[model samples]
Target: MHQWRTWHRPLVLFAAAMAVMTVVSGVGLLVDDRVLTGAAIWSKPFKFAVSFVVYALALAWMLTLVTRGRRTGWWAGTVVALSSFAEMAIITAQVVRGKRSHFNHATPFDESLFNAMAVTVVVLWAGTLLIAILLLRARIADRASAWAIRSGVSLALVGAGFGFLMTQPTKEQRAAGNLDTADVIGAHAVGVPDGGPSMPLTGWSTTGGDLRIPHFVGMHALQLLPLFLLAVTALAPRFVRLRDPRVRLRLVQVASGAYAAVTALVTWQALRGRPLIHPDGATLTAAALTLAATAAGTYGALRTGSGAHTSPSAEKELVS
Candidate 1:
């Protein structure tokens, strides 16, 4: 296991910054009684702060896993850190002013701020792409971890791209008036307006499909895929099926594909304006197919890579 100090320094500091923001936002949520968009004014900042904390930490840890891309990865990580900070700063500042952070139509100043936030997204995407490219060229010895890192990075990029869907003018927005001068250009929910009945803390829409569902699911693949590998490796001794490196690699690949499938399905559901919990028959059928495919893949991995036919000594040497 890597030590805390060994992780990417800038990203670690960025994570720490987000942690402080989290605390401040939490305090704001408790003390400030103001509401925006039918939710607490501080709610958006608080959620963003917590999310960036996890994101920065995961990215920092990821940077530590490979040795080859240290220089380029460090620079990319710095960009990511800066972008994260700028985004949080904008969100927090808007909260302090008792206003909506995203898709604010209040004044020209707020629109400028939102434009700056959009710039950060572009910078963040570029930095993430650089890091992903570098990671593919990294020299990782463990096949399972290597596959996990590569697939995770690729999927995370896809997830980030899905977020751009929110930037488009909503159907209601277009229907209302001229899109060229629309006050609110972007929204989180697909079918309904921004601030409706939402889930308790996360503010995910219950009345309409939330784009954030796919966005969240996709972005976290960077952490989730690697963690899945960690889980499989940890359970190797207890589970004979997981002991084989080939099996572990196969499982990670299957998981990566399955995760991508899930992200796609949710994005599809959101595009059709279907709430996640209230899936129509098509959504259910797609989900069922995904589940079936994943199960079949898992079984195939176990059957082919169980190490049952190979001698113990040879198998150990081959893996090492």
Candidate 2:
């Protein structure tokens, strides 16, 4: 309801496309490898098609920003979309070429290529996050609505950012020449010869033991937590004078705390030899924080709203 007229259509389309693609990808996963005679050829088309849809959706979303004076954000998002398209195009091309290891092939899918793709996607997504933050900071939108929008933007970008990183071969794996040939590996494969994961589990590698897994997981929380905060803030009583100031302070507190907590939890677990995909104490802690923040924000907003209901007397006094 808050400025849904701005970017609602594009965002909805993007969400729908993403949902459909997710189902498609999931179904593809269920299809046994041996059954598909042309697995790569048939399998890859879905992804490629999904990739184009995503690209178009992203572009459309950016277009919605022109009214908001977000030229920079638009361009940044465009670049990320382009990079993603490039990645998918390359993978589809490899599949078309009958490359067995479409993901991790040392030949065409080399480290440099991966590095470029990773950096571009990461930077672009991060850029989107920054733009969302800036949008609020610039006061281009109402405080309550801006907060919600920014939080959603941050979460989606963070999720996508780590997703990009997880697709690439790790530095250590590349250095040791023990990289996996396929982009997605099953759970039964042998660990890296020298001491890597036998198989990639939910995009986490046992071999290099990088922070990729936790990072990806942490980024996803950005969506739920921030939106919850925004919602609560929106429903709160309008402070006659200091409402904006108070909301801004709270938003900063929540965002900073959540970011730090997630980062710490992820880092600690990864360093302590825990894999990212597996549920553990640290991940649970992060989840708790996210839930707690949402609850607190909701409760605070209700309390404020309740107080507003009783403020007519004060308003009469001021009027007199």
Candidate 3:
């Protein structure tokens, strides 16, 4: 119980609650056949609930880094939790009403809800940005862990910027004069019209580009980068002989750079109205270059560590 309390902070507890809600909402999805905006109404709640799990966990993990201003961490976590819950509540309510949660200003009530959601998201983004800055400024003892935390939050900020981009009117919508007719004028789909044919469960557009793809990928960097470093730290001792902490840090840095590059490439592809699976020659070339660079960096790290002796303390730290 003490260990659980040590690991599960307020943000983590909030995440656990969201996870339970996500499971319940997922069950609701199984029963509801009713479709809204070309997808099940229950899908919104399920997705948001699941996303909250990620957000809360990331926030909790970040808060652990701040040695000072623990109170500030708690306050930031509380604000984020409340804002996220409000956003989820509004989305769930819209789903219950059988209406779209985002970009649906058709009715006065919906418009108000939409505005409220917008405000909540902005507040959430601001709070997240503050936390990211705090983490970046903190002096962590572990170099690899520090790198991971810094890169994750920085990349997450880039992802949050994409959310604002998603709120702008798409080219198609602007061309069709949807801005005049619709109360809220924005879309997730880039090249194709919104609510078109989508992938099975994710609802990502199958026929055209989707901005949400990059947004989702980018936002999750907060979770992905740190988890990746942890996994590398755990597996490196058993699988490989290279045990230098600096090498491990360099590898993670390379991986973070690769992730950011890929996120940018996907966002560029979507903005150009190109689907992810159907990448053009230029996109393919860019991807190949990014992979090659990452591979080269990893190879260099390994080569540099080939003859270097691992310190007992460093090895212990890596294993821990």
- Candidate-wise lDDT, in order: 0.86, 0.48, 0.82
Q: Alpha-carbon error at 229 in model 3, in Å?
A: 1.1
Off by over 4 Å in 3: 1-4, 178-180, 313-320
Tell me how candidate 1 scores on lDDT: 0.86
All-Cα superposition RMSD per candidate: 1.8, 7.6, 2.4
Give the Å error, residue 84, model 3: 0.4
Ranking of predictions according to lDDT? 1, 3, 2
What is candidate 1's lDDT per residue for 108-179, written digit by digit as tens?
898899889989998998898988888888777778888998898888888888778888888898888877
Q: What TM-score does candidate 3 get on C-alpha atoms?
A: 0.93
The count of residue-pair clashes in candidate 2 stands at 8
**Candidate ordering by TM-score (highest first):** 1, 3, 2
Q: Model 1, 300: alpha-carbon shift in Å?
A: 1.4
Give candidate 3's error at residue 289 in angstroms: 0.8
| TM-scores of all predicted structures | 0.94, 0.54, 0.93
Between candidates 1 and 3, the lDDT winner: 1
User: Between candidates 1 and 2, which one is better according to lDDT?
Assistant: 1
Poorest 10 consecutive residues by lDDT, candidate 1: 305-314
